[model samples]
Target: MRRNVRVAAYAVCVRDGRILLARWTGAGGPRRWTLPGGGMEHGEDPYGTVVREVEEETGYQVEPVALLGVESARRVIPRRGWRRSAVDHQAVRVMYEVRITGGELRSEVDGSTDLAAWHKLSSVGLLTRVPYVDTALRLWRDRPPTGRAMGSP
Candidate 1:
């Protein structure tokens, strides 16, 4: 198996009972809804990566308010697109709560995300979303004071 490691930052931006999300367009088949952030570039700080990703994916300026948690996971992805072999991908994800500061809302063209919009927090289930969205929302609402992540037994 081909092993790959990725480090990414994600934002949970909520306002007026709605949450901002970007439709992720990866080499995989279908698009999945996720927070407005993505992988950090070489030697890039996580904070700067989140800000840059949020702006690139969803034309909006944001300030990360608090660091929510970190998530590490491994998944198997089938060979597709340019990938000649299946990949065992390990991702270290940093979750953050962010506040929108400025800029207009617009979808990214010719990028990993083609659409960006707000979804009603109560109705997020209607959209196809990545697992991180669920985890981030749970973390945001639970606000575990100890700063420890919860896991299923």
Candidate 2:
């Protein structure tokens, strides 16, 4: 079995009763919303990854106030409809209840996100949000330990 692991960070930026989210355009043309963050660079700290990704994707600087949780997932990728490979992505995301330190919200033209906006937390389910949103929220609500148990498979 071929395996790959990836670490990423996401920010749960809440401000004025709203949460910051990014609309992502998927390869299948579907739009999905998610928190402002992304993958970690080699040897980069998870906290730094979120801060950097938030700025890059949302044009806003955020400071990580707390670590919400970590999550992982595994899937099989089919190559040309026959050959397949198992891929595992483990994200040690340090979700922070962030406040915008600076910069205006803008879409990253040359980045993973296409649009950035603030939405009421209550209305998040009404929009097309990535699965991670729910997971992150649950973790935030529960406030799991920094090195607590692993997420469900």
The best candidate by TM-score is: 1
Clash numbers, per candidate:
0, 0
- Root-mean-square deviation of every model: 2.3, 2.5
State the C-alpha lDDT per candidate: 0.90, 0.78
Residue-level lDDT for 81 in candidate 1: 73
Off by over 4 Å in 2: 81-92, 146-153
Give each model a TM-score. 0.90, 0.85
Candidate 1: residue pairs that collide: none
> What TM value does model 2 have?
0.85
Give the per-residue lDDT digits (tens) of candidate 2, residues 1-153: 566677788898877768899988776668899988888899999888999998988889888887776777556544444566555544455566676789888889966779999999899889988888888777766776752334655
User: Which candidate number would show the highest lDDT if scored against the true structure?
Assistant: 1
lDDT by residue for model 1 (93-149), tens? 888999999999999999999999999999998889888888889778888775446
Poorest 10 consecutive residues of model 2 by lDDT?
A: 85-94
